[model samples]
Target chain A: MKKINLLFVLTLGLIFSLSNATFKTQGYQVGDTAIDFSLKNIDGKMVSLQDFAQAKGFVIIFTCNHCPYAIANEDRIIALNKKYAAKGFPVIAINPNDPVAYPDDSYDNMKKRAQEKGFNFPYLLDDTQDIAKTYGATKTPHVYLLDKNRVVKYIGAIDDSPKDAKKAKTSHLANAIDALLAGKTIAVSTTAAIGCGIKWKK
Target chain B: MKKTFFLALLLGLLAQGAHSQTIQTIKIKDLVSHLQKNDDTLRVVNLWATWCAPCVKELPYFEQAHQHFKNQKVKIILTAIEDELPKVQAFAQKRKLQSTLLFLDEDNANDWIPQIEKNWQGEIPVTLFVKQGKREFHSGDFTAEELMTQIEQRLNVSKE
Candidate 1:
């Protein structure tokens, strides 16, 4: 009788835990052709994915004004844009979090952040969050690197560190860009990106 | 009459205790020991700020996960990374965060962020899944479903 009761309890426990199981969507995959989406930049001008397809490659990063990770990397991203833009590559920043939930990440604040940071790239806001959803971006500072053919070469982190740069173990994003620029295939195509999760519209 | 007065006083004390079951604010230094002692159980620690919109949006998912595993032995601690104590407290009050909510008391980001996750870039809404020293740090907002899957997967691995 006790054995039967134990089995019943264990079954009940398993059922309870499994009922709440949820999974993140697997959207874009490596080697998949990148999709095109139009989003308004901080200056209110609409930018599309196709705008940069003519380049040798492009760095697409989902970032916002309030996330410390994104804020800390603003300088690095800007530098990447300047260095790579002249070399047929550009960095595109997208704000995917809900602006209402975060007033600091609103369009006005994005513009302020861009101006204050002297961002050379187009800092766009995904108002409907469609772009972010399509990309399966779960956090601020999520990155996607695409080659000239618009195939995803890398889909993960900006770098290995969000806190102390001196101690980072890997420069995943930069290394990927370097490999692509030098006509070498990237080794680490995906990584578990760490940062502020996206604030989806409630 | 003396007995009645004592009974009334006892009831008042109980009421106070019930109404003031506020989450005790423990320093990060103290939290490590508590976590260590609670081994054999999964701990999902989220670093967020009440001011962070993405953090706020994903707060409910964490709360749901906590409730789902309440009877089990999992601990879901939502630690606010807000430096402003008053604001953190007020936000907690306003949002009615029911999980074990804590405010990271550390102010030196350069010193502390690395301690939490070497790759952490001082971002809010960062979550850590730890079980028996096996840890996974995900920097992004998650839906309730995604959070639960990760928790379940971690717990399964821990059990194994």
Candidate 2:
């Protein structure tokens, strides 16, 4: 009886510690090596981080069609990819919202929106929402800039302004990329832009 | 006869619409100062948006609590962030949101997110429940039963 009780307590302790460890590994921070995912693009193709073989890094943005903030930054995101895709940094947008909660965010709608908005980059679908969870994307238009080695060089907003891009005082994402190209340290790494929170799976 | 019934229904709908008041836009500093009262009442500040599905889903819970705990010194305020006023006004009328409505009149989320709570990463459907002696934060949706349990637990703790 005594031995059994002792074993039970030891097992409980291990379970508690393991659960705590799982909570601690919820998401990524700066300098963390990001895990690659194979999500479906709007083109009916499976796209992964490793697919960009010749690229230097990626600009992973969690955005959707419904969110106004995402819609506001749509043009800016396209411009980023157009200017930077050949420069070795390509933009990869992922829609993490569950279609059940938001029918507009369905894969079909994603394709339509991409076409309507004239997206220059791959707008992927995180059907499982695992990528968004692991990346710790809290809001729509959240950005994570990666380097050649897939290390998260910078994270957070695209610019200081979300409501008005042309009136933005500073372009944080662009500045970060410029510094990376120049082999210099990024000055302002993370910034927060007011945006619609990413719609989570129920 | 049918036209008269339709006119009556429209009048009733308009009467119902009168209950949906416009949300006040308050600065973060003003909001914080408003929430800074030293009274023993429990202030429940819910951070939400008009477009947030989860926030909309959980709104009824806060509304129900607002009614059930009215005499218990619990005040509920629904604060919207980054949404168009007209859209939110329509939604407010459609949903018949009973909790006091307000909009956080500030941009630069990084600047104000920390002001609301240091650990908050600008997620919607976050509730800040506080009494004079104790404070608790809850993130995501909550059922009315769960919300009441939490409030009761806090009230009990603060009493002790």
Candidate 3:
């Protein structure tokens, strides 16, 4: 009877562990409360969503230096921060790529890129990639817009045209923010675009 | 005499161009139609781009699969999501890629990305395996062994 009980307990533990792994991989969905992360910023200071007390929301973008798609959207990311930071939704960029696989996406390079681009936002490093995993950011230039309460209002690409901003027909991220600020329902809360996959550490 | 020589040279150049594989530029609708085609052939559609390093690295695996499955009904299509034709053409020529090459000419990825796979978040190195009416979308890079195993498993599934 003791052996049977031990076996039953082990089996239950195994099932729970398996389910937990699945849940983590699925990451956040729209309306889900996003967990704040303390990632090291380019300025060598730790930053988190909770730090912005006065802000109405946050625009968290997972982007890297090596990706062409990310590079193309660099200007637009700056523009987003310039146009909306005062509106209470500031852009916070994160480099989630593994430095081992992509050396260009290393912390030092991220800092260099941020400085060169004259980023008007905080460029942070997800060294352990935990934040990216939790947010379910699969590719560079992936966006996750969260409300002041930390509820994820939007996820996916910044806009329709990732390669060329001039050719973009729709601004999904901006639209979601506008809707949220206006206290209206976001029509297109989620979108996807082609981008370089996040280089996971092997 | 000079005109004849120039004409001969032009013909030779044209013949050379014809011999080399040219990538066909296609719209999202064309791709959808291809995917919707009801056929026994297992269409292994690899969505990639020239600038994506991982995509470039894993391309040889698809090329090898294309060569290996030459006699079989397995079709390997390397669809590039690049706008510049010259770059894709040059890369294909330089690499000597043997798979069926195609260039997705659509700009609005948010519009057409869902058409390919609803859950796809527009990441490169994604592959779409289609046979009959069944479809399987695999995101991320694949090793040669893993690529072969996946193809073999799908082929076997189609047989049954």
Candidate 4:
């Protein structure tokens, strides 16, 4: 049965090809140097991590408008800037979602959201997602706390609670910032919290 | 004509009343216990949420795999954490998801994220394929063809 043999071979070949799925590398781990970028902010001006000359460090947040988790943290992000910007660890937010996939996160909508939220920090757009990729961002509401040297001192969720901000008992970002400000080692270098996966380009 | 119209309307309403999707909220301990040791069956647990776009996008792939590998010993279960019953149920019903669906009640993500996977950062759309107490974890979206391949690979590994 030559025909049967050929059919079997073809099926095997298909299985082999499928089994070889391509694996892409993930983003940076803790203790890694975070990459800097110049992405457009809601103000229509390009913003870079190096632009904040006076800051001792930064609270880089990879967030988007479409994600409910990000929406929940918007006010808290503003608060972080209000409290820390004056003390030098300003919040620098970047949206990494592809607007074509999530039209609500488009530049125009970003401008509107920033104004509506009264964002005290720079809400930049990661149009190419290069900065996000370099920093190893996997989802929205992801946070990376870095020193003035751009060294990522901490990474993960803002706090333990995502549903209700009031229920948050431990402020992870605040603790890390405080440690850096006090010139003490961060108590918790990394932590995980459930978040919306970044909407990557199709 | 009026009687026929009324009769048809009644039947439509009755048919609409019958819904099939089931959403359950269970403790993490129960979930861990459910991952029973099975040498022949491949259990695929997909962690997702209503707010996660990638998880929603990759659902069809799991569904297609379930249908295509009907004769194979494979089970696909979807677990959504953080989404309450109303939201999780609505999304499952709207998508007509055939795979088993669940909602995780344990909130303190810091406590559970590490328990599930030491390396996982609590991101949604994470899939775990388990066979014979061995697990293969994949984070992010997977195409249908790629999923099928991964299934076959896991199956083959377990056999050896």
Candidate 5:
């Protein structure tokens, strides 16, 4: 019985270690201020997070070319950028996935995708993935919204749909952006992001 | 001789194409039918995609657990929701994914995603451990050891 007890204690310790192996991701709250970082855009131009923050607010989307969820929302993102850019709220899209594992999400493909899709905003690459790590971006299409003060206003899914746009019941990203633009508090500050998980380098 | 060799190569290519295994695309209907069989058989289903980095990283763990529990009445399925069928089939073949491979071809995932679990936020690498009516949905990656432990615990506690 003593031997069995020792074995159980050892097993419990092993389980705790295994479960904690994954890096702990940070969650963005409503009042948290977002830090700025420079990253290369699809056109090979250096774009800084502060460049967009000069305006009323910014839409920082953690996205990649490969994920179907990101691909599906391409149009919506473009539309949001075009619609809100004039209002001093432009989208600062970032590709956070490691390029080595996913060649499709590399800088070259990002440029191709941006040009092909006619993205109005700067589609940047988080080359070192530091920006993604800082923001704790875990999904391909995770979103982060900031107000004029550079405080994180929202962090969550683009919408409630991956395939069918008609069936989407919630527009978390949109609602947050609209509320910020209209000078109103966002109703939903955070929601669990859904999409292809970000591939991080070992 | 060159012409004959070229002809042989062409024939080989055609044969290979003909013998290619079809990626069984699972719809909601098929999933329901699969669940109906051996209602007592606990099912641990993982929804993933070939392009998803975390999903690809953690898939071998699930496969290992599936092999470990093969003797038991439990069933494990790994569904890849790649828009391109050929890519998924090629990936499965390359990885030799042993966990009853499935391709979810539905363009509208919201319809079926909720059907599997309402709490699911449409995240890949999400795991569903279900036995009879009891269900535990986890939305993240797990190591081989962690997954095995989870399988053992869930299976033991499964009432039905």
Candidate 6:
């Protein structure tokens, strides 16, 4: 009986270790202080959250040129900047996709798309994919709203309806921003939306 | 007249073959029930979208698995998240997909995503494997060999 008990304990130890081996690190959560990045914008200039000294907060969106979901929210992102840039919370779009895997998301293509779409805000490139990995951005169009101190206020989708703006019942990002501006607690700090996965380099 | 009749018959047969796999639109509740069904079979539910390139790339692997495990108790379900039914139908037809296709019609992803898998960050090409109430969620694309290995492991487990 003692030998059997020992065998069972050994099996349990093996199972626990195997499960831990497969476990992944979830990078950041709401209320975590997000690290600032010095990524290059489309205009060949380095930009960072610290550079926006006048800003009260930021709408740091992890998006790209290739993902259809990102394309769908292009106008909405622009509108967010237009509406909130003067309000001290501007939009900072980041292309976190690997350029090698998706050439459409290359720095040159990003410039072209930004110019063509008349993007009012700075569209930066997460060339090394470090910022995205740190922020735990898994898909295109993932939003991480931060306060002036760079504390992550909200994380996830921009709105309930990601494909269509008219069908959006609740703008999670907008609502969070409004609550932050008013010094009220954000009703929903996180959300999820189906989107194209970020292509990591092989 | 005979030629025309034969042509019509051929077209009918072709249409039947083309539509052998039809896309069904279901709410999250329906999907949850299906997942919770008490059965000994291994269900490979892959959540994908038409616009996602990686999802499209990994679809053939699922189809291959379906073909290989057709006689076994293994079922492959290709579920589309936040996509239009017509587009999914057209894409399935174009690709000649053989696996069962499902259009997850629910739009509130934040609510349903956790229901499917608590850790799924709403990324496309994530696959869920269910067997005898036990479940395993894979959050990224899979190669053919990798998928086959997973299915084989699950099948062996069910036998035991």
Best by DockQ: 6
Tens digits of lDDT, candidate 4, B45-135: 8888877777778888988887777788898888888778788888777777777788899988888787667777776778888787766
Residue-by-residue lDDT tens digits, candidate 6, B23-109: 888999988876876688899999988888888899999999999999999899999887888888889988888898888888778
- Candidates ranked by TM-score, best first? 6, 3, 4, 2, 5, 1
Task: Show pairs that collide, candidate 3.
Answer: A193-B122
Q: Scoring only the second chain, what is candidate 4's TM-score?
A: 0.82
Candidate 3 residue spans exceeding 4 A from truth: A1-25, B1-20, B158-160
Between candidates 1 and 6, the one scoring higher on lDDT is: 6
Of 3 and 6, the candidate ranking higher by TM-score: 6
lDDT of 6 at B93: 86
**Chain B TM, every candidate:** 0.78, 0.82, 0.86, 0.82, 0.77, 0.87
lDDT of 6 by residue, A106-161 (tens): 99999999999999999999988989989999898999999999999999998998
Candidate 3 lDDT, B2-103, residue by residue in tens: 999999999997666554367889999999887886789999999988889999999999989988999999999999985588899989988877788999
- Model 6 docking grade: medium
lDDT of each: 0.75, 0.82, 0.89, 0.84, 0.76, 0.88
User: What tens digits encode model 5's per-residue C-alpha lDDT throughout A33-128?
Assistant: 888888888777799756654588888998889887899889888988888888888898999887887899988999899889999889988888
Residue A33 displacement (Å), model 5: 2.0
Candidate 6 or 1, higher DockQ: 6
Error of 5 at A65 (Å): 1.0
Ranking by lDDT: 3, 6, 4, 2, 5, 1
Cα TM-score per model: 0.61, 0.82, 0.86, 0.83, 0.66, 0.88
- Writing each residue's lDDT as its tens digit, candidate 1 over B22-100 gives 4556666755544455467888888877556667788889878977999887898877664467877776666666677
Give the share of true interchain contacts found in each model.
0.20, 0.32, 0.75, 0.71, 0.36, 0.59
How much does each candidate deviate from the true structure in C-alpha RMSD?
A: 8.5, 5.8, 6.3, 6.1, 8.1, 4.8
Model 4 agreement with the true structure over A17-91: per-residue lDDT tens digits: 544322234677778787788999988899988888998999999999988899999999998899999999999
